[model samples]
Target: MKSRGLLSVLTFSEKRENLLFLLLNEPKTIAEIKGYLNVSTPEIFPRIKEMETKNLIYKENKYYALTPIGKVVAKFFQPLVNTLHVIEENEEFWKEHNIEAIPQCFLERIDELGNCRFIENRLEEMYEPHTEFFENISKSELVMGVAPVFNPAYPAFFLQLALHKVHVSLILTKNVFEKVKNEYRDDLQRFLECNNTSLYVLDDISLAFVVTDIFLSLSLFYKNGIFDAQRDLISFDESALKWGEELFNYYKEHSKEIKSL
Candidate 1:
């Protein structure tokens, strides 16, 4: 019956049960607990009061610690918890996936084993480097962008910028828009509407480019689909940004000039 009740408590939990287990490690005063949990007295006292009411803990020298009941519960939970950790050992699924933003607090307490291998593999994947291109993008405070190919790699930089809330403006060419406009319009629109994003579309665009506050990038398209990495690419520093910005402004200001063709 006692073990069944313990299992019941574990099953009933909608969130972290680690705190209950941690409490059994030592007798601690209410103030000490509030401090360690980084929670306020008001938020914690009620739960402590409830645990005491259930006789799960008792006070000694004004320090409330887990009772024998709580200790037994914690011990019974250990094996079930450890069995839930087999997923951490898998290394394959993570290679093709990204889970960079999951926080530590969420990761530590997970005890389920079924998806453990996939998750472990997913967590081990590393960032792929684009060398100079990534370096320039990372250093920029302002990035003016256009993406013709919708590279999955491109979204990675945007996610990084999102963490810092950096400002970015994107002007995509007509050809790129038409190709993706029907299929990915909603997702692309939301990304453009997200915080710090400003987007524009330019029709009849003959070229593709991205300019950072300090650098400029240019790429050309081919009719035969023979686009190679070395073909028509250029990178320049501050001087290029200034020139590119001026060219962008001229094109933006004279939208009517290129509207027909």
Candidate 2:
């Protein structure tokens, strides 16, 4: 038999999707669905009938819940819905930034960036270190990151952070690593000498992101592959911090430790 057409199965209505998601947890009575959805029977019944006809749900006594097929379908649809919500939450950030710079595997799990916020330096402060960024990372006991580009302030600030006894780990792209070694050898030396710091070098990387115990900040390349220095997607949410740490670890695992530089 031919598979249900994509539009036909999933595109019935937004209410259907919401109902499917709601039922994934537990069966609910019509009154419960109506109360949770905040809609009257006239607004919700037709969608429920349609879902029932599609075998997406079943009614027993007074409660409605997903069928086995519906649960599987919801398992797949939830991610697509969640990923879209995340990207759209910071629509322009994801739109203008070169999201392709994010690796394919992590990009697929982009929804893991729960409740991220777009943060930008003011025009007058465009080239300066972000105050909020400094504030958040400064207070963390452990900080880790990947940097694909150079920053004049970072060498000093990160060294200071390490000196303050914060454990610091970083993965830098080759060019960025060399740039720091050539331009800020003293700071690089200080960082290396500090017991709290470790550095690694990757031949190439496509994006910049930092994760600390407190927060995560990510900056992406522009669509043409040029780095964007002015804006970052920042988040203090625990899930986002976990996601960012995984991203940092991905590059670190693929990189070589830089004991000298």
Q: Show where candidate 1 strays beyond 4 Å.
A: 1-129, 148-152, 159-163, 178-181, 222-228, 231-236, 254-261
Sequence-dependent TM-score of model 1: 0.40
lDDT, candidate 1, equals: 0.54
Please, what are the lDDT tens digits per residue for candidate 2 over residues 198-244? 99999998888889999999998989878888898888888888889
Candidate closest to the true structure, highest TM-score: 2
Pairs of residues at least 3 apart in sequence or in different chains that clash in candidate 2:
none
Error of 2 at 166 (Å): 2.6
Task: Give the clashing pairs for model 1.
Answer: 87-116, 87-117, 94-121, 94-122
Q: Could you tell me which 10 consecutive residues in candidate 1 have the lowest summed lDDT? A: 113-122
Model 2 regions lying over 4 Å from their true place: 1-9, 236-239
Model 1 agreement with the true structure over 82-133: per-residue lDDT tens digits: 5443334443322222322222432343232222221111222323324566
Which candidate number has the best lDDT? 2
lDDT of each: 0.54, 0.87
